[model samples]
Target: MSEHEGTYRTFTGKTYSLYGINTGTNQYYKVIKKLADLFLQQCPDKKRLLFQIQKASVNRSFFKKRSGKNINHSLISFIKKTLRDSLSVYTAGVKHHLRTLPLSQRFDSTLMTKEEQYHLYMLEIELVNRIYKEPFKSSQYKFALLPHCLRDFRPDCHSVPGDVESVCKECTERCFIHLGSLLLKKYNIHPYISVTMDLEKLFKRLKAEHPSIGALGVACVPELVNGMRICINLDIPPVGVPLDANRCARWMKQACESSFNLKMLEALIK
Candidate 1:
């Protein structure tokens, strides 16, 4: 994956790249590049640069001012052109692009303000999630893939691991246990902790055993995009509910409580 950095051609002769996110440093660029490479590997034949921008810490003026020398004039032009006209027009254009183009070509947020880019990204996620809502609701096997970062980062918040997924032992975080039980008992939605990093394998194995499987992922904006891509590639319809707030240790040091719109979760089941 690291080798995919710095203008590498894909197997299909496409000039794909894992573009840097709001940084001019080589190290940060390389880090985003690796993540983009993993995403591309999951679903090849998608010709576009994966913008590895974190929703919580995105720098809006990344392309506004040149950073040393690694400035991309064309990328700047693309964003400016897309956003220069009318605000409503740009919003509509974003929708059209997301609907028609592949993931990579759908966005070029290099020049947009941080808030604007985050808004566009959220729109894309919302649209994609809604597109899969019906299929997801009808799937035979439904899963609620919860992230470990959503847990309260407490010394006593120990979760028990199982062969398939981790069980949320009623520790410091009651939300996890609450949602897990609610999903299982009421909606018949199996709950899984996403920390094991075996999602692809687990889905593949379960898919082999079951005819159809769908998942409702609870994650931040970036993980939602990655998870949606993988689910689409695997032919598993998925709907996502972004966390109410990004309480991950990286973003918020003190508050580790996991929160989301319970209404949205219930709506998905309904």
Candidate 2:
């Protein structure tokens, strides 16, 4: 396996690795871009496309009922079918993961069904990125919130509190957080380790401080999509790259080291 395809424990025994989804290539991102294009072709309106995807993610039967006169139900059904077949390989563990989910988190928005949380949310991130990438690039002030799991835990982390969240001290070159921070800073985007749990309050404060702000997120799929939605509602153009797997404590009994596609992050920002 490649460094990006290292074997790691998952919530479900089955792996949901995205490392080689495209067969013989590590660029699973191309698959995502292609699928996003297909979805976009079916629903040209970005906002409505996102809304319909989000709806399908939460409820599998969303496409079954008539949504509205303006909505194209037939095209929406086609998109749903394509997502199931194309995205299933990357979401193999979702069903088993949901079966073992804690009762307390059963109703959590992040713990939606396999199709909703895995397939639809994957498309949602791509769509959100397509819609917000240019605005995020042009904003006068830009910042990024990276998941703490991306930090190299072998050494004592030197991350310290920043104006918004904890900032990486770049103590270890092997850490993905350190590597991602370097690239983000090179593009004039401030990078912070996302330690805060109250995102809504944090975003509200940020909007007041930087009116022309844009936000970028590096998180697992469910959290990343929700964060993008929060930013959009607050008028902060947001872009994000999802972690390769959901190996955090919230998903697993103990947090395991995880990585995101660094190349994908640069692509979204640049």
Candidate 3:
């Protein structure tokens, strides 16, 4: 129902741009913007707002299930109003709302909890599923970028810098990182560890080498969100997988150790 100057249609019949999608319901977008603002402010009433938003979402879900393809302007208007009102709640369930939001759009690292970060990352993973279904099949040039945390940090495990990026020593047998590396090698996918957050630099190198590259990244929620935003800004198509759990020093108060569902990750390869 919308048109943009430079956009491409995906296999799913959805059109998007690395530039951006500028067409969406104004009311819906407005509510989203407002929620993002409140999130940044760390408003105290976030919980109450989240409760209302959740109720509205449930109602919307029910309606869609019962009346698929019967959506009307009035229903949309009602939903928007519900969201707007919910966001007005004072010092409420912000964490609950953050848990449901896709990528803490306005996430403040200073205020965000590890639990909220995990939820936001999960949302990003959900969005990746919707946006880049069967990504490996669609992307000609792809890279597998996994987090360094996935490395086994126990005794005798060691990692060192590589020619292009940090190299996984691949010391631990049967670990998720090892399995992920094997899968990438099997698929002929360029694999790298995101030790540095400067993806623009990495992508610049990738452009020089591959000319055009899409990325299949594995990271925690905050890092995933940060990487995705950078990719979007750079017009790079990326799909992502979140870690199974948060094991970073911030969350665990110790050295980091992370993993993912190898099966889920391999599914993206083919």
Q: Residue 122's C-alpha lDDT in candidate 2?
A: 79
Candidate 2 worst ten-residue window by lDDT? 6-15
Give TM per candidate: 0.55, 0.87, 0.55
Question: lDDT by residue for model 2 over 1-270, one digit each (tens)?
Answer: 444344332322223556534432235577878988877776788888988777655554554464556556676678778877887777777777777777888887676546545777778898899899999999999999999876644458988898889998888776788888998999999999998899999999989999999999988877888899899999999999888777776666566787777777877887
Residue 93 C-alpha lDDT in model 3: 35
- Please state the error at residue 149 of candidate 1 in Å: 1.8
Model 2 segments more than 4 A misplaced: 1-15, 20-25, 60-70, 152-155
lDDT of 2 at 27: 57
Candidate 3 runs further than 4 Å off: 1-121, 133-136
lDDT of each: 0.52, 0.78, 0.51
Q: Please, what are the lDDT tens digits per residue for candidate 1 over residues 210-260? A: 668887888765567667767877888878765544456533435465555
In model 1, what is the error at residue 41, expressed in angstroms?
A: 34
Candidate 2 global TM-score: 0.87
Model 3 root mean square deviation, Cα atoms: 16.2
Task: State the displacement of the C-alpha of residue 206, model 1, in Å, after optimal TM-score superposition.
Answer: 2.7
Candidate with the greatest TM-score versus the true structure = 2
